[model samples]
Target: MLPYKNPELPVEDRVTDLLDRMTLPEKAALICHSRMTAGPIGDLPGDLFPSSEELISERGITHFAMMAVPDPVTMATWNNHVQDLAAATRLGIPVTLSSDPRHGWASNPATAHSGGGFSAGPEPIGLAATDDPDLVREFAAMASAELRAVGIRVAFHPMADLATEPRWARISGTFGEDADRAVRMIEAYIAGMQGGTGIGPDSVACMVKHFPGNGPQAGGEDPHFAYGRDAVYPGGMFEHHLRPFDAALAAGSAQVMTCYSIARGIGVREVGASFNRELLTGLLRGRFGFDGVVCTDFNVVTGMEIPGVVSLPPRDWGVEDLDDVAKTALVLNAGADQLGGESDPGLVLAAVSSGAVPAERIDEAVRRILRDKFRLGLFENPYVDVDAAAKLVGASRGRELGRRVQARSLVGLKSAAAPVAPARIYVENIDPVIAAGYGEIVSAPEDADLALVRLKAPYDKREGLLESAFHAGSLEFPAEEIDRLRTIAERVPLAVEVYLDRPAVLTPIAEFATVLAGGFGADDDLALDVLTGRAVPPGVLPFDLPRSQRAVEESRADVPFDTADPLYRCGHRCPRA
Candidate 1:
């Protein structure tokens, strides 16, 4: 047996043995984390990238980020097939599969996948609303087990970024704006996912992300687009944003993912976090002492274009003028171990050949990458039991816990005139069948005892295909929608529930609705349970609800709880009446 294949060998020894025998191409493949399609066993048509089989066999790629939310059985089978492909390679290096947050209701194809065949849980903000680190740990434990069942080893989440900017598109994914609370939640998350034994077979290594915080985007726009590339710190809260990452590193997080935004106003160069040596090597590695794998946010090396679906230029930010080879070299020299959402191994080879990138840097990155795979025990057994997957993934107990969490995470802002037991409920954006279980469903507000309305936090629609997925822009509801809501409230006593993906300007809704609440990610059933007297909403506001769009616009993006006279302060909750 090869020394690297020996189970009894030390992981470092195994990594060294493997590194010695690996060809330059194999090392290059290990450092590139690319996206892969998930569905049937065969490659689906209309795929813009190479197939999994082609990636592993031809390019020797081992790391993949799966975006699809297929059924557990199909996912397990596909994972097994991927393992089979990897096992046939010359070195038999097992594939490491990672995914964005998949146990939540939020389904942005660009960010998180839907909870298909997985236990449904509240978003990270909802977990923060609970303000229970133990419960956060419990959710993470459940998510970790489910992920491992379907052969996913890495979790691209527990986004430690503070939601300082209330209008940030990705606020729902964060643990809220409080640095101290975020620290507790992030530590618990890492402990739950990685487990007490650390990055072993039973663990799903947490890649605590958007390091140095991604929440302070200038004007609350995402860094995914050119217009939103700058992450400004006008409030001088740049160091404050690093608190959660400090806690994450202390908790033994296995990996870190950089943000796409170009950090400005700090001493570092105005470039994306992934290509900033002072941030990655100086701050994260040197000051914080985090030596784990640092993966860049997706598609930083090159732009992507899927015919008619999406067209995203490379999020190179300040370094867009650099060629692909130069970009690749800069990322490597910046101390990132992997290029996320990138598939071309030829670029790495080209960079090294042209002397733009040092061969020593490649070796160092390969060592870190190989070390993680070994620590994860993927080297010994990469394949999962197909039969166990169905039974283990999204089990009944897990789903029940999710439902309970969802109900508990609903934050009541106003409940003074909430209906205790209305006979007829007029519903909007709610399942009539689910409403029937609680009360008689009425079609019109005039005929009903009370109106139950569900709304999403306001966001102006963007035209770009990929850009639209991010819920950016204004927090105020449109004038027409507000007018319609006003009409309903006037007809009958109104109970309003808004999904707080981002903090909404709730002043208008609060003025009319007798009962108003905010939720992060809850199902119709769970929302109804809270609306009726069946469930008591114990959650508090994770972040402030701005009083108006003007206050939101006036507030500094880098500072938390900066909006003046917010409709509801952070941690505000209505007492049960």
Candidate 2:
């Protein structure tokens, strides 16, 4: 009944069966890219690994990252379907379903891999708050089980960057401020994610991220954009950043993701880490001895963000925005073994024909991709039970885990107005019944003795040309919101909670709103507890809120956050008595 083959054969044999007959185009498609892009799903109209599998069968792509994968059931169904498709091919090459770390409940975009609807688990800050490596690993192991259940063999997660300054909001996603803490927690996380027999065929492969550190984005901000461009360490604190990577490498992580955040005047991100030879082959593969697959961060390629006007539907074959071949060459030369986004294999095939990249290079990348597949034994026991999807994915255990992380990761920064928790609480946005438990929640800010306002603070650092060109012409809060806050402040002790991801310029809270509290990825009760003092507010300041734009512009890149000595410090905490 299986298309790929009977699950009994060794994965190597299965792969070899498929590998021998492929043409260059099929192979190029396999090794270069994977996606969750728009398209109908189902193994390439009955091809292995979804729509592309048939092409690979006709040609030679033994390795490819799986995409469009739904929840656990869909994941298993798709994976099994891929294996079946492989069996139908002469080679019956099995594919590995990889994921962004989908644990507790939050789907981290930071990954190309994930099982959707994951619990909103605790991030690095929460893990750090626990200060328990065992707990960290426990979360990892649980995540591993969830991933493994859905037939995901690889997990792209366990970010281990050291939180260097207050400006970096990404710190919430990492373990903590100290390098040692990050290293230790990462070790535990890997152990947990790897699951069971340590390093055996059944373990989930852990892909540690943003190698060589990406935490100290200049100005305590993310380098996702031009203004946040490149990581700089004039402090020479670069070595500290490398510690986690070293630990992960030493621990034998299955893969490493190159950071999109560029470092200094070094390397090229016009193509990103996939094209950074200094980063890929030189440092990770060579110096670190990382034999595993090295991949690029999402949509980092030159042509990925091309103008829509140039690209037409159904392969209309029109004039384009970027030269695909040149970008492909850069990726290959930079030692990238895979591609991200809507990269077509036609370009690689063209390159091969034109002698731009030797056929040997294609083979090199293809073989590596296949070899990893061989190593994972995907060829054998490829199809997972559609039922296993239900069993492991939405288990109550995962939800509990997420809830716990949400609790621990709650970082209580500043609270000026006295904490207030009336059993009957009123909120403008939350549901009433839901309010009854936290207190009788309300729909309007004006009615309650205590008003809880949820505000989303700034996160991404200055990037995009538009962003760089952005000038803060004035500091102003919304008049109505401010007026509302002032009114609420008058009626009752107001609790203004913000989903603070980055250090914000807290200009004049509208006098109406009183009692300010904020932290990254806040859970409702976590905010409530911090207000009621039911839970001690253990969150600390990861970045400082500057009072003015002039001070931000004058600051040096790579300098620690709070450089201007704003209103907060690293350890500033407001705990319940």
- Please write out the lDDT profile of model 1 over residues 1-577, one tens digit for every residue: 8999998989889989999999999999998899887788887687666888789999999999997858899999999999999999999999999999998878888789776699988888998988888988898899899999889999998798999888889999999988888888888888889895368888999898998779999999999888889888889998899988888888999999999998898988889989999999999999998888999999999977676666778999999899999999999999999999998999999999999888999999999999999998898889888799999888899898888778778998887745778898999889888888778887889999888888999898998777889999999999999999999999998888999999999898889888788898888988876666566678978888889999989999999999998888998876782
Enumerate clash totals for all models, in the order shown: 0, 43
| TM-score, cand. 2 | 0.77
Shift in Å, residue 220, candidate 1: 0.4
Worst 10 residues of 2 by lDDT: 311-320
Put down candidate 2 lDDT per residue, 164-266, tens digits, no spaces: 5545546556765656667777888888877532344567887677766777776655544444545777766666678889998777787777676667644
- Model 1, position 375, has a per-residue lDDT of 91
